[model samples]
Target chain A: MRQSKLVGTLAVLPSFVIVAGFMAFPVMFAFYISFTKTNGLTYDWRGLDNYIAIFSDPIVHQVFLNNFKFLISVPLVIFSALVCSILLFEQFKGWKFFRVIFFLPNVLSVAVIGLIFRNAFGYDGAVNQFLGLFGNEPMQFFIDSNYSILIIILALVWSGFGYQSLLLLAGLTSINPAVFEAAAIDGAGWWRRLWSITLPNIRKVLGFVFIINILYTFASLFGFVFVITAGGPGYETTTIDFLVYLRAFSSNNLGSGAALAVLLFFFIGLLTLLQNRVFKLQKDD
Target chain B: MSDSISSRLTPRAKWPIFIGMCLVAATIIYPLFFVVVTSLRSNVDYKRDPFGLPVDWTVTNYIELWDEYGVGRAFLNSLFVSTSAVAVILILATLAGYALAKLPVFGSKFFTATFVSVMLLPGPVLIIPIYLVLARLGIVGDYSGLILVYVATGLPFAIFFLTLTFRAIPDELLEAARVDGAGFFRTLWSIVGPMGASGIATLAVLQFLGTWNELIFALILVPDAQMRLLTPTLATIGKRFVSDQPLTSAGLFISALVPLLLLTFASKYIMRGLQVGLSR
Candidate 1:
């Protein structure tokens, strides 16, 4: 028994070691370095000075605000996904082709998504060129805070809606047929059935989509911003992750960077806790 | 009687919805199509007519990108990192998932908790620390360093997927193997491994795709231009050479090629995985 347990333990140990070394230990190490001044070369104890400076800085405030503005993409993306999924669920003529084409954005690298959007919206790029024929002057995107962030949100919507609609479509498929039949026989029209029967049946899947996309809005917007704006035209469009990267590497201010990373960690942790609570509440019903 | 909810839609609803979907699909497809077309054209040709068929369609941009910008090398680097990490993850997750699903591994409870927490740790939080860990270990900017992060980060999902997968295999089989004087490891490799082949393959493919599409970690750890992976390299080009649409498009096309293919061909498995993920 002991030897069997030993073998089992040995088999499972490598994963733990890698996680502890790369993930677990560094989490605490990040906390430690957050309080100190360090850039992989120099380490000096600062004792909350880093946090103090970051809190007082207006750029950090703007980054946080930028992250909040980006949160607006969450509902926008879910709505878009819902619309697409609902349409695709109809299995209309050429639905298969539409479904495949729709999901194309999700599979490509975010860098590729960013490039497509940037080039399409660049001053001399396709969108402007098309607009130019309508007698409008050239307009620039991905160059400033508001315009670039708006473009980023549009990019997010374009990329995520199809993939998520697939998830919702799967949700719609798995739903029992009898419920839809009952709703239809009772004189519910298509839109009425969608609202009453289809939407109600997919609460859990909808919840799942809602949860992941919310988290994605917080943690996963980096690649989009990095390629499209590079957090540029100053610190205006910089979300938290890009700002953290910039502070840690580009700005040569490692302590504050570590501090920013740790702060964002706590913020996300709190958000996750809150999200889980809401989800659990919904599940209880 | 309930063939589809579509049965309820009047012709009016169906026509408008179909047209709307067609417009949406056209919007999504045209930009990617434009990029591919632009990639084939020279800068001069693209400038001459951005929307037209490539007047002087040439693969010169691709050939030049390969020779000059090291994008080809980066593609190889991306492949090596993604594959290497997936290989390690498969091995570790298979053994560990099997143990958790069947074997009475000591401290299994603790291991499960740790993995769950680590899996939930946000990427922004992990980036600095993971990089610092690699830097501390003197492995930053190395392929091994990036591979290590991928394996570590990827394990939770792979193990979670496989644990559920391995559960469907009956305990009677394991007991039977044990009675045959087969040790636990031997049974795992022979009986469990083959039986769980489908799940293992799914795990491998998903992990490979996820790692291949990763950006920030590779961008930060492997900052050396020659060592950069495909997405990161493409980003550098997109940012630094925004004016050179032809060159940038060629790199974007290369970065997109494999993933686009996988998403097209293997979408069945991937969608099934997504369904499973949601159910979890």
Candidate 2:
């Protein structure tokens, strides 16, 4: 029995090693480094100083605010996807074709999407050229902070709505048709059925989608921002992830970078806790 | 009764919804169309008619991207990184997934939960420490360093998927294999591996496409010109040569070609995987 257990352990040791070294260790190490100050070359333990420095900085405050502002897209994306999924659920003509078309962007590298959008929005590019016909000047899409944020969200929505809708569509498909039939037979309007039946039935997936949207907007926007804005126009468009990269790699300020990362990790952990609560509530019902 | 109601509602609802979906699809396809058309146009033609059909179509931009910008070398680099990462992830995750699913390993449940939670680690949040760790190990900017990060990031989803797949296989098969005196590894390779072929294929395709298109880690970790992957290379071009629409467009298409094909063909498997992975 011990030998068999040893074999089982051995089977998993490689993955365990990789995860521990790359993921687990770095997380804890990052937390420790966050409290220290370094010039990217060396470090000194100054407990809470890095955290204090970051929170006090107005630019860091703006990055956090921008991140939370990006969260507004959460409900917007979910609602749009929910509506689209409901439409697709009707098995409309070419529904599969539409689904495939929508999901195409999600599959392509975010880097590619970012590049395409960057070019499309570049000065004298297609978007500008189109605007020029209306007598508008060529705009610096990445230079303006508000404009950059809008562009970032546009890219996110363009690439992700199809995939999110597909997830919701899967959730919709899992509902028992008889339940819908019962609702229909009881004289519930379409809106009534959707509000009470469809929404409740997909509560768990909706929660998951919301959590994923937060995580995505928080961390996964790195590639897009890196290519599109590069956290440019003097950090006006910087989200936390891009800011962290800027501090760490570009500026060689590891301590402050790690501090911001720790905060981001805690933010994600809170979301995870909320998700678990939702899961429990879902299971309870 | 339900059929009749839906049928009655169809006329008013269906056409508007169809048109809306068509508009959405058009929006989704527009940028991609722009990329392809602009890639085909010469610089002079692009300047004249940025939004309209390319009047002077040319493959010169692609040739230049490949020959001058060394996109071919970057493509090979991306291919090597993605394939290597997939290979590493598949072997390790399959073994781990099988153990957690079938083997009577104590703490397997704990490990499974830990693995799932790894997805929530917010990847960019760890860039600082990971960079430090890799630099400490003297592997920063190396192919192996980037590949390791790719393998680690891709591991959790692959393991979760494979664990679910492995669980669906019957216990009797493993018992029968053990009866034949096949050892653990041997049984896995012979019985489990073949049985889990579809799961393995899904994992491979997903991981390959993911690592192929991954840019953040590649951008930061592999900064060397010779080591830069396709996505980062494309990004550099997009940033450095923003004025060269034809070249940038061609670079974008080339960067997207492989994964776009996979997304087009194996879309069903990918979506199913997303459903299972997300809804869990």
Residue A244, candidate 2: C-alpha displacement in angstroms? 0.8
State the lDDT of candidate 1 residue by residue for B22-134, as single tens digits: 88888888888898999998888877768889867799999998999898898998998898999999999998898888877899999998887777787778777788778
Segments of candidate 2 deviating more than 4 angstroms: B1-13
Which lDDT tens digits does candidate 1 get at residues A1-285?
A: 888788878888998899888888888888988998887777899999999999999999988888889888889988988999888877777887787787778778888898888887876677876887789988866555788889899898889988889888988887777777777788777778888888987777677788778778777888988988888778777888888888878766677888988988887787777767756755533
| A1-285 per-residue lDDT for model 2 (tens digits) | 777777787877788788878988899999888888777567888999888888799999888888887877788788889888888888866888888887888778888888888888888788899999999999887778878888888888888888889988888888878887788788888889888998999878888888889988887788888889887778777899888888886665688889888998998899889888887776643
Fraction of the native A-B contacts that model 2 recovers: 0.71
Query: Following a full C-alpha superposition, what root-mean-square deviation does model 2 have from the true structure?
Result: 2.1
lDDT of 2 by residue, B51-167 (tens): 889876789999999999989999999988899999999999999999888886767777777788786688877788888889999999899998899888888888888989998
- Model 1 residue A232 CA deviation in Å: 1.7
Error of 1 at A273 (Å): 1.9
